[model samples]
Target: MELIQVSHNEMAALFTRPSHIYNSVGFALLNAPKADSVEFLTFRDTRLRGGLILGMCGAMARSPFSAPFGGLLLTREQTAGAVEDMYLLAAQFAAGRGMALRVTLPPPFIGPGLYAKSVNVLQRLSGGCATVEINYHVDLRGVTDPVELYSRSAREKLRQARSHDCRFERLETTPEAIARVYDVIHRNRLHRGFPHNMALEQIVATSAVVPMDLFMLTVDGTPAAAAQVHRLNHEMAQVVYWGDLPEAQYARPMNLLPLEIYKYYLAHTPVRILDIGHSTDGGIINRGLCDYKESVGCRATPKPTFTVNLRREI
Candidate 1:
């Protein structure tokens, strides 16, 4: 029940914990923390109880990921009392420095029961939270036919691609594979007037810290669509980025791609939830994107950022 500034060695060890990629030391290394005071906590005994990453900005203590969702990370064995203790320690630390606390938790789907416990404890301490985004996932358990989850329009698109020479394969997660996938996604974003956030080097560096999977939907043995997936944990794999080549978009690579992505995770890995990622930008839901995800059999969950008033006389 003590709070201390984390060391580099401790940060690296914390990366191995069951947490979001953004909450890891690798991601923290990539982005320079802006808070004048940053709290990198490693709460442990003989066994690690949990970890918390918070950077303080004046009166507000926030997780490093202000835009992306990440924050308090706990182990599967972490009890409610343990979680509360971590928060209480963090709050005391922040209060001493005249600061508040903030954390952007991952969607409930990533860890349903775990998430519920976490939010409940955080709410008890942090007071409440503000919804930042709506995340989506494709549940792959107890499903014989993967295509059954797709919408009618999506099914029609798949039918349209039936005449094309299409094939889906899981590519090795190499530099070349990442570069190729990055190219398709970059172009896809630009063509659609959507903002592109990642660079090739960023993806390469991140893959070194976490498990990454590359998949492609090829037409006539040429890459037409691609998806770069990150294994969030034993139970989930998230598609961080995915897109089809503009020229091959006519072939409906997307329709074929989703089906392949769903099947590949269900068969090749222990992943039961394939996270399609968020369908919102800063809490503003994009209806078209939401529809597309739903059409592909994705379910939604609220991913919010919590705030705890540590300056109070607690």
Candidate 2:
């Protein structure tokens, strides 16, 4: 096995089918503007097997908070030996550059067993000091019928929202539309006292590389709530950014928007999972946030972050 440094285009070409949006080269490109430096690393045997896209903050530290989730994107046929070799090479590279390696592995969207090899490799490398974040996702596979899948409370809220003559619109990905979506998201984050995850420029740039759809819920022809959804792959879709006016909460547009989004995908798309992302901040879980997601028929999954002290390992 050999580890090589490749361009972003090369990495994207090699890992043609990424399981999660966060693991894709497109996501790394979106984050590139904010990063001091970005590097795309590939691990190969006789052929390209796995790769990772990483960003750095100066020479001493790697930027961990840039991407929501990023680590190894590997094929199932790759052996455990290949996994170890890639990880060790990564560790050595980080050590040589005087940087600590930090990466978060997203939950497996393919099969439950797909992440087993990576988890084992991470555990050994991180000295069993992995931190787990609780993530929520709606399983859309068995949801042949929306009535049975959604909770009673959620269903009732959706009905109430519809009775108010709420309309859900799937907007085109135009610059004006993206700007409007970003405005709502920006205000929502400020209201909640949460830091902005990505700038509008970053979001716009990334959306161009990876196709995303913007959905909005309007009441009486007025925009109430919206979300930027990423079609991660054939099997999964994710709600990356969601926002609603404070006044819209009174009308229950939040509940209505996601329900409608799920319904549309359930009927029209082959996607099976709707990832709502983590309800945690800085390793602390928010019960109210988690409860709201549960009320809408979402369940928790474990997403773990792994860190290695390259200085010590070297």
Candidate 3:
């Protein structure tokens, strides 16, 4: 097996159709401003097997805090043996550069076996550590009625939102609209005592490379809640950022925004999963956040991160 570094466009072509939006080339590029540099690594045998987009500062580190997920992307046939080979090569590459290697794999929304293979390989590597966090996703496939997927309480909130004349609109991707969406997200994060992971400028850069849409829920012609969704592939899409005004809590536009977004995808697109993303800080699970997601018919899945000291002799 051989590991090679490729150009941005080459890496973009390989990862653009990934099962997770966070692993896509567009996401990596858009968020590149946060890293000192970004590298596209590919693993091969007799044929193309897997690839990953890595961000580096003093050394390459894969933190969900910086990027939602970053690890090996492999074909179905590439299992334990291939995973082992890839990591070994990755270690060698990192060692050559005198950098430690860390990677976090997204939840097993794509394939269970692949996730297991990756974990097993990481465990075998010297000084390896594996940690996990919970992520939630709403399954939208095979549901004839979108309302049927929500909990009783969520359904009632949707009804209440509609009663208040809450309307959902897909905002045009213009500079003005992007700025408006960013303001809502910024204020929401501040109110929640968290920082924005990607700045407004970074989000705009990402929009240039990825297919993203902004949706807003309005009441009396005023915006109450908004979200930005990124298309991962034919089967998956993710809500990268979502928030509501503090005053809009009474209107419950947050409930209506996702409900309408899910319905829109269900009726018009082939998207099977709507990723709500992980509701955790570091490795700790936030119970209240998880419960709210579950109430909206979202199920929990484990998203794991693995780190290894490449300096250790193996």
Candidate 4:
């Protein structure tokens, strides 16, 4: 088996279409923006094996991250043994440089066997690394009806929007509209008590990998709300980097935007599932965020976040 470092475009192609989480695309997107330097390692036992595209930093030290790197895409056949290849390759790649291997995987609570093996391999490679995971999935083959898929509250929100003359329009990602979308997401994060780490440069870089569209809910001519639509391998549509303008809050465009996007995917795109991305945990520990998502039509599904201590060294 041989491990090789692929170029940004190659890694982007591998990740932009594969079944792995969108974070992979985010990595390539943020690689140049956040980090002073970047390297993309692609493992190949036969096809693309397993490896990480990490940023260049000093002494493999841990730094606060806005999001995790993407999950490695490995076929069921190549899952085993291939992990060792990745570890050794990454180590060598960071050799002399003394950098830690930090991999962030976003998988469903119930992932394929290869997924579990990945965690086991990462543990074997690193001694210590910060980790976190958010569980969200795409049901590509089932659940396409927006109305049927929506919970009662979600349906009601759409109805309410129509009653209020809230109009929905899907826009293409263009330079002119980029800042507008960013402003909405920026304001939303502020309202939700989170910072906007997804800078414009990263957003533009990331959008270059996969096909992207913008969904907007408008009042008259101004943009009230928007969500970036990432078309994933024709199977799923990822609702990523969303935000609502302050005025949108009063207009309740948050509730309306999702339904419009859902309906658009159902009618125009070949997407079978839509991943709403991050949600607060429900169960004994309930959060308003999770509650809000649930009210709009999300059900609690099993998801996991993992961490590895780099000092441990697999």
Candidate 5:
């Protein structure tokens, strides 16, 4: 097998589909900002027989109080032993950098048990160099009826909105609207003490795959919340960045946005599953955030994020 740097054209082809994990857009955004450091290790034809994409950000700040931060990304494939091959490439890449690595593994559409097994294999390969940061996932397929899917509190919130004569519009993205959505996302990251992924212009450029309508969420003719969704594959969709303002918080636009977009995906997109990004049980440190996602018929499933301490190795 061979490892090579993947160009934008290559990623464009590989990350074309809906993904529960390993977003192409995210990769694109990261590389645009840190093109020199961010590396993509890709596997070619081999006897082990599978392909994997590993995202690496080099020379990043390592926290003395905690494991260093890096990025992990993998594409979904049908091969059962692919995880091992992926880990082999990742370990070599991480060890060479002499920096701690952080891996965020989201639940794959193949189901939870197999995902667990793959995690075990990856752990074995990365060895002392690796540790899991968190596991984030949820199962929303349990509720057959959309109405019955909501929790009691969520139902009440929807009812309250109904009492106020509220309505939802899943807006499409235009050149002008993409910047607005990015503004909401900027606020979200600022409040969370995180950096924005890319400049607003770059965000608009990579949003070609994100449905125009689902990018913006409005309440009663006012812009309330916005999020970008990407299809993982034929069967799943990933909820990427989401942002809401203080004024819209009272309207609960964040909560309602998913339901509307989900319903739209259910009706139009071929995705049978949805990955709602981070949650608290997955070590996200935000109980309210976790609870809010769960209220919309999401059940936590286990998918691990890993970290490694490499500065001590030498």
Candidate 6:
């Protein structure tokens, strides 16, 4: 097999079906300005296998230019051997260009076999993993009400949230509405002493291209909590950002917000799982925050980031 650089249009077409939004065309546009440059490279011989659109940072080629994690996206059904060869050839390309390789992959549930093989191959090439973060997701298959799996503590919090007159509605993803919701997220982040990494304009621009939805939890007709959801693919969705208003914390809208989100995916779309995003800062686990997610029917998966010096033996 050979590693070849393909046109942007060709890469876009192959990644069109059931691929992560972070690697899609919309994200490519958003990712371009953030990087020095970007390129599309894939493995090809008789047929095109898997590849990645990397954003260049000096001599380092990073897979995810925008979101949490994205490495090699498979374009067709291929074997484990083929997957390993793709990674090997990708490293060769990087070495030829005098570049390094840095790829971070999402949770394995997105593609079980592919992710497993990727992790093994990346580890072998790099000699070890770079970092691993705990990512949370709510499994939605073969279920209706998400509360059935919630812990008693979480259930009580949901009950308290329900005692107040609350409403959950999916907002129209207009630029104005996105800014309004983003302000709430910004406020919550500030209150909690966390940096807001993404800007309002990026979300608005991405919403125009990808399938983005806004959902809100209103108590007594007042906004208490809101969440920005992104459909990673037809089968998976992610809660990009979600938080409760500072004053609304007394109502525990955070609990109810996630529950409503789970039901929305179960009832409204082809999606079978809802990624709750990460509760980690770097590789450090936020125990308190992560425990709370588990209480609300979420499971943790190790999302790994791999790095290799292409100039070395790899």
Model 5 stretches with alpha carbons more than 4 Å out = 1-33, 37-48, 54-56, 59-82, 93-102, 110-114, 127-144, 184-198, 209-217, 280-284, 308-314
- In terms of lDDT, the poorest run of 10 residues in model 4 is 60-69
In terms of lDDT, model 1 sits at 0.78
Model 6 over residues 202-289: C-alpha lDDT tens digits?
7888887779989888899888888898888888989888898899999999999988888887787899888988888779989998
- Candidate 4 positional error at 33, Å: 4.7
Q: Write the per-residue lDDT of candidate 5 for residues 63-148, one digit (tens) a residue.
A: 11111112223444435455555555555556666655455555644445446655676566446344332323334454445657
Evaluation by lDDT, superior candidate among 4 and 6? 6
Backbone clash count, each prediction separately: 0, 0, 0, 21, 15, 0
Which residues of candidate 1, in runs, are more than 4 Å off?
Answer: 11-16, 30-38, 43-48, 55-60, 64-67, 95-99, 124-129, 220-222, 312-314
Could you say which candidate leads in TM-score?
6
Lowest summed lDDT over 10 consecutive residues: which window, candidate 2? 58-67
Clash list (residue pairs), candidate 1: none
How many clashes in candidate 6? 0
- What is the alpha-carbon lDDT for the whole of candidate 5? 0.55
Best by lDDT: 6
lDDT per residue as tens, model 3, 1-314: 89989998988776556656667776777678778788788998788888867777676555332666766765445768888888878876776777767878766876677778877788777445767778889998787777787889888987888889777888888778888898988888889887888778777877787678888887888778889887766788888899898988888887778778888888778888888899887878788888778887888888877776776564
List the candidate 2 regions with Cα displacement exceeding 4 Å.
59-65
Candidate lDDT scores, in order, read 0.78, 0.78, 0.78, 0.61, 0.55, 0.84
- Per-residue lDDT over 271-305 for candidate 4, one digit per residue giving the tens place of the 0 to 100 score: 76676766633213336666666666665553333
Query: Looking at candidate 1, what is the lDDT of residue 6?
Result: 78
Residue 235 accuracy (lDDT) in model 2: 76
